[model samples]
Target chain A: MANTNASAVKKDKKITWKEIKRQKTLLIISFITVVYGFIFCYWPLTGWIMAFQQYKPKNGLLHSKFVGLDKFKFLFGDDVFIKVIRNTFCMGVLNLVTSTIMAILFAILLNEIRHTLTKKVIQTVSYLPHFLSWIIVTGILHDALSSTGIINDLLLRTKIIDQAINFFAHPNFFWPIVAFANCWKETGWNAIIYLAAITAIDPCLYEAASIDGASRLQKIRYITLPGIKPTIMILLIMNIGNVLNAGFEIQYLLGNGLVQSVSQTIDIYVLKWGISQNDYSLGTAAGIFKSAVSIALILVCNWWAKKTGEERLF
Target chain B: MNTKHIKRSLEDRIISVLIAIFMIVFITVTLYPVINTLAISFNDGIDAVRGGIYLWPRKFTMKNYTTVLAMQNLVTGAKITVARTVIGTFTALFANALLAYVVSRKRFLFKAQLSFFWVITMYVNGGMIPIFMLYKNLHLTGSFWVYIVPGMIGAWNMLVLRTYMLGLPDSLEESAQLDGAGYLTIFWKIISPLCKPVYATVALFVAVGQWNSWFDAMLYNRMKTEYTTLQYELMKLLSSVMQQSGSADTAKNSTAAITPITIRSAATVVTMLPIICLYPFLQRYFVTGLTIGGVKE
Candidate 1:
C-alpha cells in the first residue's frame, strides 16, 4: 500500500508539470503585467531615493550625492512651503465640511420629494457637473465670474456691489471659492451613497414612526438620519484620510498671480518645484512627506474607526 | 379635530410647496451654466463680451462653432481624445479582467500572492515625482502611449473585477474544464460572457477616466500638439484667453464679430456636450457601478 501511495504522488508531480506547461499563455500575460506594474507602480518607489540625494537628472540615482534630510529641512524652513502646507490643510478642511454638509442636505431634501419623476430628473441634472473635467468646470466658472460676465452683472443690478468683483483674483475668497466649487461639482455625486443608505432602511420603521404621530421633520430626524449614520461615518473616516488633498487641478487652473499664495496645494507645489523647475531632490522630499503623512492619516483614521466600532477600511 | 386636520393638511401643503420651489431653484442653478454656455457659443462673440447674454443668444450666429472646428489643433485634439478613449478603455478592460480572472481562480497556486501585489498598490504609491522620473526614463514622455500604457491595469478596478469574477458560479468553469478546455478558453468563452455587467461597469469608469484626463497631457504629453486631448486643448484656450492680451492669434485675427470669450465658451461646450448627451442613458449603469464598487466591501 505504501509503495502504491508513493507512486501515486510521483504521478501527481508529473501531472503538475504538465498543468504548468498548459498555463504558459497565462503565465506570459501575467509576466507582461508584472513588468508593467514594476515599471509604473514599483519602479517609482525606487525614485523615492532621490529625496535623500542631490539628484541631478544627468547624475541619475546612483551617482547623486546623498544629502540626508537637508531637502526636508529646506522645505520646512521655506516660508512659502509653510504657507503652502497651511493652504492645503485649510482648503482640505473647508472642502470636507462644505461638501459633506451640502451632500447630506441634498440627499435628505431629495428623499423628501415624493414625486418620482421630479426626483429622477433632479438627480440626473445635478450629476452632470460631476462628469465634466475640471478644465471645463473651471472654464465655465471663469466665463461666468469674469468682470464682464453674468455673475458680476447680476450682482451689480441687484445693488450687491457697485463694482464687478473678479472672484478668482482675490486671495481671501480663494479657499471659499475652492470649497464652493468642490461642493457644486461633487454634492450630487456624493449624495448617492447616502441615498442608497436611506433606501436600505426598513420601510416598517417609517411606518411605525408615522403611526406614532411623527411629523415629516421628526421622521427625517429620527428614522432617516439614524439609518444613514453608519454610511456617513465610514465615508467621513475615509475622507479624513484625504485631508491633505485639497485639490490640484482647479487650483492650478483658477489660480493666478494674485491668488497663488493661497491657491497653491501640496500637489501643485510638488509639480512646480519638482518637475517644472527641475529641483528633483527637493521635489522628491516633498513627495515623500506627502505620501508618508497620507499613509499615517489613513492608518490612524482606520484605528479610530475601529475604536468607535464603525466599519474600518482594514 | 376638524381644525387640527385642516391645520395639518395646510402645513403639509406649505412644506410641499416650499420643496417644489427649492427644487426649481436647484434645477435652475444646475442648468443655467450649461445653457448660458450654449447661448454664449451661439451669440455674436463681440456682443457676448459686452455681458448681458443670459439664456439665449443676443446676435445669434454659428461662427464660433465653425471657427473652433476650423482650428487644426482642435481637430487633432478631437482625434486624440477619441483614439485614446477607444484604445485606452479596451486595453485597460482586457488587462484588468485578465488579471482579475487569474487571481479569482482558487486552483491557481499563486493566487493570494499575485492578488497581494495589486492590493498593496491601493495603499502605497511612489508619488508623482518618482512616477514622472520613471516615465521620463522610460521614454514614455512626449508620446500618446503614456496615457494608455501606464493605466492598463488599475489595482482598484482589478480588485473590483476580481470580486465580481469570484461571485460567478464555479460550476461553469468546472464543466468547461471537464470538456478539455484550458484556462484561457474557459475565461474567454464562459467567464467573460457571464461578467458583462461588471465589465460594462469597469468599462464606463475607464472610458470616462480616459475621456476626462487632462493632467497626463499637462505632464507627459505637453511638448507635442498631436497628443493634446480635447480637455487639455480647452484648458489651454481658456487660460490663454483669460490672460491679458489673450494669445496672439485671437488678438491678430480679431474680427468685428468674434471675441475670445465666445470662442472659449464654445470650446467648453464642445468638450462637455458628448458626455452630457450620453449621461442620462449611461447614468443607470454608472449608479449601479458606484454602489456595487463602493459598497459591499
Candidate 2:
C-alpha cells in the first residue's frame, strides 16, 4: 500500500528512490510547485544582488556598476535613517504592546459574558473596522481628528483645552494616533484567535475550578490565562517578524510633512527612496536590512520558543 | 449557604452590569467614526464644512454619491476591482490548494522540502524593489495578470491550508489511494470537501486583500486606465483632498454643494461597499476555520 511505503520511506530516512518511484506521479504533479517557488519566491532574491551595486534601470541588474557596500554606507550614515529606524522601532513596539493587551482583554471579557446573543452581536460589530480599508480608516481618523471635528469639538465643550489641538500636525501625538488607529482596527480581529484558543480549553477545567470555589477572576487568572498562553506566545513570535513592517499604508496615509520625522517608518523610507526617488539600489539596501532584521527576530523567537518548551513557528 | 448564594448573585449582577457598560462603550467607539463619516457623506458638502454633522446628515442630499458614482474611472475601477477580487481569489485558492495538497500528502516524495521551501518564504523576503523588478522583467506589470500571477501562491495561506489538511485523518487518503485514485483524485474527492472551512477562511483573506489593495494598481498598472482599481481611485481622490488643504481655494470656497470632504467620504464608502456587504455571509466559515491558527501542527 502507498501508506506502508510512505511510512517505511519516512522511517528509512534515506533515498529510497525505488519506493518513491512508485509514487512518481505525485512527484511529477508537485514539480510545478518546485519550479513556481524558484521563480516567484527564490528568483526575486537574486535581485538582492542589486544592493551591492549602484543599480541602474538603464544598465539593468547585471550590467549596473557595482559599488560595493556604498548603498548600505549611505543608508547607515544618514541621520534621517537613524530617525526612521527609531520611529519604526518605537511605533512598532507601542502597537505590539497596546494591541496585544487590548485584544487579550477584549477576548477574556467577551468570553465571560454568558449571554450568547449579546456576545455574538458585540463580536460581530467589533470586526467592522478591521474589514474597512486603511484609506477608509484613515479617512475616518481625519474627520474625527480634524481641527473643527468631533475630538476638538468635544474638547471645546468640555474645556479640555481652550484651543483646538491639531492632532496630525504635531509630532508627539503621531505615535499615539498610529497606536490607537491600529488598536481600533485590529483589536477585535486579533481577539478572534485568542477567543478560539479559549474555546478550545476544556469546559471541565471550569467546572472543577467552580467546585473548588474558584472566583471568576481567579478562574480567569488560573485557567484561562494559562490555557491561552501558548496561543499568545505563538502569535507573539509570529508578530515579532512584522514588528519592522509598521505597515506602509497607515503610516503613509496618516503621515504628513509636519510629522514626517516621526512618521517615516522604514517601509515609508523604502517607498520614498526606492519607488518615488528612483534610488532603487538604496531602497533595496534598506529593504534588505529590514528583511534581515525580520528574519533574525523570527529565528530568535523560534529559538526562545523551543527553549521554553512551547509551540514554535519555524 | 443562602448568604453565599446571595453574595455570588450580587457579584454576578455587578460584573454583568460592568461588562454591559464596557461593551456599550466599545460598540460606540467602534461605530461612531464610521457613522460620522456616513453622516458627512450624506450631508450637504457646504454645510458639512461648518462642522456639526455627527450621527446624521444636517442638510440631506444625494449630490455627493451622485457626483462620485458618475466618475467614469470609478466605474472602470469598480469593474477592475471586482474582476481582480473574483479572479485573484479563485486562482490563488487553486494554486495554493494544489501546492498545499502536494506537500500535505505524506506519501509524496520531497514533502518536507516542498513545504519548508514555501514556509521559509513566510519568514524572509527578497525585498520589494527586486520583486517589482522581477515582475517588470517577467512582463507581469501593466497587465491584470500582475495582480493574480505573482500572488497566486501566498506562502502564509498555503502554510495555513497545509496545516489544516494535515489534521484530516490519514486513513481518508489511504483508503482513497487503495481505490486506485491518484493524488489529484484523492485531493479533490477526499481532502477538498473536508477543508471547506479553511478554504473559506483563505478565500476571505485573499478576496479582502484583493479588494482592499491599491498599491499594486498604483505600481504595476499605474499608466493603464483600464486596469486601475477602485481603491486606487479612491486613494487618488483622498490624497488630492488631503494634500489640497494647504491651498486657500479649498478653504475659501463656501458656496459649492460638492466639497472635497463629501466627495472623499462618498468615494470611500463606495469603495468599501462590496466587501462590507459580503463579509457577513462568509463570517461563519472563517470564524470556525481560523480557530486553528496559522500553524496548528
Candidate 3:
C-alpha cells in the first residue's frame, strides 16, 4: 500500500510536467499577452500618482512633490467642477431613460411588423447611425441646427415658428440636443438587443395569447415584455456604471462659451484640467472621482439586482 | 360580434396609420440632416450660403474637396488614422483572443484568477493623470505607439469573447485533445477558425474605435502635428475655421470670404465618407457584437 501511494505521487508529478511541456505554446502566447497587458494597460496605472503630486512635465512624475489630497479638495471647492458633475449626471440619466424607452418601443413595433422585408429595411436604416462617429453626427447637428438649416426651413414653411431658433447657442437646449443625438445614434442599435430577446420568446406563447382573445398590446404586456424583463434589468444595472461618462467628443465638439455651462460634462472637465490646462493632478483627481462613483454605482445596482432576484453583472 | 369586429378593425387601422406616420417622420428627421450635409458638400460655396438647396446641390462644384485635399495636414492625418486603426485592431485582437482563449478554458489553472484580475481593472482604473504620467515617464508621448499600446486589450471585448467561447461545446476541445492535439494546436486549428463571427465582430469594433478615436491624439500628440490623427485634424480644422468665421464681425477683413459653408460641409462629408461606406458591410456584426457584450446572463 505504501509502495502504491509513492507510485501515484510519482505519476502525478510526471503528468503535471508532461502537461506543462505539452502546452508550452499556449503558455508562451499567454505570457506575451500578459506582458502586453502589463506594459499598456497596467503600467499606465503608475501615472495615478500624478493625482497626488503637483505634476510638471519637466520635473517628471518621480521628481514631482506630492500635494496629498489637495487636488481632490480643490475639485470639491470648484463651482465649475460641481456644475460639470450635475450636468454629466443629468445628461447620462436623460440618455439612459430616453434611449432605453425608445429602443423598447421600437423593438416591439418592429416585431409586430408582419412583413420581413420592411422590418429588415427599418432595422438596417436604424442601425446605420450607430456606425457614424460623433464627429460626423456633430457635423450633421451643426448644419441641421444652424440658423438657415433644414429644421428651421421646415419649421418656417410649416409656420411652426416665425424665426429660426439658435438651438446650439442656447444652454437650455444643450442637454436635450445631446440626448436627442444619443437617441438617434443608439436607439436602433439598442433595439437590436431587445429584439433578440423578444425573438427568444416561444412562438407558441403568442399563439396561445391569440387563442385566448388577447389583443396585441395585451399579449405584449403579458408575454413579450415579461420574457425580456431579465435582459432589460441586466442592461439597466450594467449601464448604471456609465452614468458619469456623459460622453466627451460630442460635447467638446458642440460646446462653445455660450453653452459651456450646460455642455461641460465630467469627461470634458477631465480633458480641460488634465490635458488642456496641464494640471494632471486635478485632472487625475476628477478622473479618480468619476471612476470611484462608477464603481459605487455598479456595486449598488448589482446589490439591487440581487435583492430583486434579477440578473446582476458580477 | 359584427359591431365589435368593426370597431376593432377601425382601431387597428388607426394605430397602424399613426405608427407609419411616426416612423416616416422619425426616419426623415434622422436622414434629412445627413443627406442635406452631403448636398451642401457638393453645392457651390456662394450658393450654399444663399440657403435655397435642401435635397439637392445648387451650382455643383468639387472645389471644396480640392481645397481640403490640398491642405498640408489632411493627408498626414489620414495616413496616421489608417495606420493606427489597422495596427491597433490587429494587436488588440491578437491579445484579446489569446487571453480570452486561455481564460475560457475550464481546466486552465489560472483562468479564474486572470479573469478576476481583468474585471477588477475594469472597475478601478489608474485614472487619467496617472496614465498620462506613466506615458510621459515611459517616453511614450509623441510616439504613434501611444495610441495603439495604451488601449490594446479591452476588458469588455475580452468578456464577450470569453462568454462566446464558453458556449462552444467542450466535446470539440476534448476530442481534439484525445487526438493528440495540444492547447495551442487546438486553439489554432479548431477554436480560432470556429470563432470567425466573433473575430470579425471584434475586429470591426476595434477598428472603428481606433479610427474614430482622437482623445489620445489630443493628449499625447498635442505638439506633434505630424502624428495628429484624422479626427483630431478635422476637429482642429473645423474649430479654427469656425472660430475665424464666427468672429468675422470682431475680426473684420479676416478671411470671411474663405470660410464658406460649403468648405466646412465638404470637409465633414469627406471625413465621414470612409466610415459611411464601410458601415453597411459591418452593421450586421455590430448588433451581434453589442448584444454579446451588453446583455450578460
Candidate 2, residues B1-297, lDDT tens digits: the string is 664655565666777788888888899999998888888889888887788888999999999999998999999999998998999999999988888888887666588888788888876778788888889889999998998888999888887788889888988987877888977788888899998889988999999999999888998898999999998888888888777665647766647778899888888888877777877677777776566554373
DockQ versus reference, model 3? 0.47
Using lDDT as the measure, what is the rank order of every candidate, best first?
Answer: 2, 1, 3
Point to the candidate with the largest lDDT: 2
Task: Write the residue-wise lDDT of candidate 3 on B1-297 in tens digits.
Answer: 664555555656776777787678768876787788788878776556668688799787888888878877878888998999999999889888888999897666556667887877777777666776678878899999998887788888899889889989887998999999888888889999988889889999899888888878888889998899878887776676556546536334434333356776777777777877887777667777877887764
Ranking by TM-score: 2, 1, 3
Q: Calculate the i-RMS of every candidate, to one decimal place.
A: 3.3, 2.1, 3.2
Two-chain DockQ for each candidate model: 0.55, 0.64, 0.47
Give me the candidate number with maximum TM-score.
2
Q: What digit string (tens of lDDT, one per residue) describes model 1 on residues B48-95?
A: 766788899999999999999998888899999999999999999999
Clashing pairs in 3: A47-B130, A48-B130
| Chain B TM-scores across candidates | 0.91, 0.92, 0.92
The most accurate candidate by DockQ is: 2
TM-score of each: 0.93, 0.95, 0.91
Pairs of residues clashing in candidate 2: none
Task: Show model 3 residue runs off by greater than 4 Å.
Answer: A1-19, A56-64, B1-8, B248-259
